[model samples]
Target chain A: MPTTPAPGTVAPAVHLLAGALRRALLEEGGGFRLARVLPGREDSCAGLAAVRVLGADALAPFVVKGLALPAQDAALIRAAVRAHPAPQEPERQVLLWGIRDAALVRGLAVSGVDATGWEGLAPAGSTAHLLRLPWVAMAAELVRVAGAAPPFAEEAVHAQLARSHLDISRGLVRALLRRDLPSAACLTRWLAPAGEQLTTPALDYLEIAGADDPRVSLDTAIARRLTTGTSP
Target chain B: MTRANTPISPQGDHDDAADRSRNVETETDAAAARLAHQVGERALAWLECMRGSFALTAETPDDHVEGQALKSLAELALAAGMVRREAIAGPQCADTAGRLLDFGWRQVGRGDLLYRLQARTPAATYPMEIYAPFAAAGYRHERMDRLAAHLLGLRASRVIEHVPNRRLAVVAAAATIGVTVPDDVAAMIGQTWLGGTPEPWMLDAGNAYGVTHTVFHLTDWGGRPEGLPQRLQDYLHQWLPVWAEVFCETRLWDLLLEMLIVGTCLQRPLFFPAVWERVAAAQRADGMMPNGLTTPPADPHAAWRNHHHPTIVAVVAGTLTLSRAISHATTAGGEA
Candidate 1:
């Protein structure tokens, strides 16, 4: 489990990534200069470039580690990606990189693995139906990045549950990274049955939706209580 | 018309920060009562002005008044009639409403003339505008039903020709009284070809008039059960604040009223009360609200005629929003 930092504590990874990003972009001065802080980190230049493409807001959750972004911000990133054209390799790496591991980004880029339904899937279609597709097919690239085998072989799962359940998978990625048990549990219960065919350990996390878990975030707490594998 | 303006706070006498501390039930009830009172007062004052004599001369070759000007009077009648029925503006307004509605109906050949008169309007000009409120007010005249059917046909013709946005007024009128639009018209209105284009006339996400009419039609004039699709709802949620700000700055009361309807449809009374405050502030002592801050014709009668449209719209907007807000607040309070 990633250590949950106190509020306002900037993670070292965030600072490092941000520092590398600053060095890459020679913008008009606004804040701290990255080149001055961390002189040489050429290895993560591609990651920095990717971060710039995907934007710091999208990559913030991974960089900050345990911090769960507000659902609205998470939604904005998805919307922004859908609105724009598909990015190239390094940029795709930065954008698709959900975890804190550099190796995962490399593996995702080289694997050239087609997320099951992504190829012919038009991003500009009805968002509701797009969200309804099987989670594995929808997040196939992320699954490969996370080293989880794809969920299905033939049939696709339609997300019959609320639209917010579609968002849970993204939230689950952050929770899995954080290893926040309560949060993961709540997300799993809500997402698992909806995308029943999905094959990931995160699916079996814990069904504690609505549990009075002060340790976890408010969203996760509410989600846990709302779904316990009993209620729809 | 105007681009950008500083944000105008909606915090009339109600401080939102303090509102947070107070119980939800109490706040909602208080807000409802206050709004209802404000709207009721304004509606009465507006009724007093509209109660005078209305012109009924047909806008043919001889009449000085353009058919467009007279058509607008009927639209005002429909709005005033709506307030009269709401029991907000006193019962005396009912006779005035009937007079205006009947006069407007008569001017448009009382649904008897088959000749497609282009009278001042760009496309076909019919009594589609007045038919909506007429039907809504429980007037069972066959002419209204006929006009509604004519509108549906016009909508069908508009769709088949790939015309955009022009059919909005007819479609809006139809929805005002719960007429189910044909599948073709629905398809035409639903999909936008210029999704990515910056063009202002794109029906889905451009031009204030098209957007407002689309919203009005889809939401069934703020009477739809759930209101617009999630995507459109999201779009309105983002741009309405900006649109409201601009319209309010330009002093475009009619468009601003439409914005209030959109706000009501989205169930965000909190975001819109500021507009109501602005409208209420703009009202003159004798109940005349100018169409905009734009200068009116120097002739007193011309100014009166010009001022009447916004005043009628303002009254309707206030009555509709306030009544809806009270209902919403009441429901919310009960739930709390």
Candidate 2:
């Protein structure tokens, strides 16, 4: 029996959790249950070597769900994140890139603490985390997300603009909202090569998004690329 | 002889400098007056726009209906309050009020709009913006109480939250409607200063809103000091001059107006006079206020919406600051 949903609190991400985790969230607490279910601190760092596999999509769902963690659990996740190798600490980096829960972001911003799991990824140059990653690994993840849809035509060299990548796009928007310029710029930079493989709207948005641009769309531009195989 | 050809004596030069300084003052005065008039007109325009149909521009179309509905109603409530207070007014105030109330009633109970808007998005400062208008409109219902409770709960639960602006917004909004702020909320605000007055994050585009929202909420939309802890007040009174300078240099009209309102809230007339001057000079003749003095978007519609933000800010800040300025002047004159 999950705790009766808090009135007016309907998180789309909450549904992504299995019933057992949801039950834990209800009976125990959001923070405690999340920390219990997450990859343990050892497991967290073990995945460090597989940075390529830990893309935003694979990470967003977990991080978004982890936001409900109580302080102790939140700290546990943070501690786990800290234990990871600096270069391969993609989970915390992704969260800091603005993939974490909305409330968590608010909590971090208000508490004046770095909610971005790892402490070293400062706001000033957080993109260094993403940029430091092997370009091929990052680029491959982008292709995987963008190419999830079937090809539009036989002659098309790239995948057609198909379904959207909600998690990645939402993270991008969150990054933009937090004014995490380093992260936003890093993500936008990664998308630049895939310019020829994007949808029209995605291409337009990419042209418009910058570290300093005030307005940003919640839509994931890169994920919806309508590349006709020609460079944008 | 042409004035340029005239050789000036020391006495003449001194007198000339004095005349030039006096002329500058006159020009500044003229500009302020012009801006005040334009702001008044533009405020009325914002109200009129709301009186018909209004959409929440800030939210994505794909956001949940509750988010949209809550944001829309909150904006409406604020607009209605603005109209009622004559912060933005027209003969259409009555009509706008009717439409707003009707719209509000239609979507009142559809979801947990209140909690979803407030607690779910704690960093957002717009929810704080909603408080003054909703309270000013004298809106009281079970939902409002629920919102008030949710805000209080968030404060109690999160020992220290991100976005000082959002914390201030919740505390200040609760204060506006006569809700007693929990000790924790007050303590939470005090915690912000514990880090030795967090330097204004002005370079971050979002902080422009965050900093101003902090000022507005801390001061309770320029209403009273009950919501503000004394230490925070002193901290703001000391640092506002520097913050206002930074905001002015950025030439962000929305922020400049927000800084003006902060000055009004603190009752510190001297804090942002230079910013006030620049804002007045930047006003267009037709009463539009652009987002900033930076390069605008290439698209015309995008450009117009950008203009809309500052124009609305100008209305709220202008109305509050100008009216307060007048009242202060009148009171000072009376005391003299």
Q: Which candidate is the best by TM-score?
A: 1
Model 1 lDDT per residue over B131-164, tens place:
5665666654564565555556554435434335
- Stretches of candidate 2 above 4 Å error? A1-232, B1-34, B50-53, B56-63, B66-76, B86-132, B143-160, B193-195, B198-208, B225-239, B270-287, B293-305
Cand. 1 TM to true fold: 0.49
Clashes of each: 4, 15
The alpha-carbon deviation from the true structure for residue A91 of candidate 2, after best TM-score superposition, in angstroms, is 66
- Interface RMSD for candidates 1 onward, in order: 20.4, 25.4
Off by over 4 Å in 1: A1-232, B1-44, B47-65, B88-125, B140-165, B172-181, B192-206, B267-271, B295-300
Model 2, B41-146: lDDT tens digits are 5554554454333443334332454454455466555544544564434455446555665555445432234434555666554444454455556655556566
Our model 1 lands, by Cα RMSD against the true structure, at: 17.6
> In candidate 1 chain A, what residue range of length 10 has the lowest lDDT sum?
A146-155
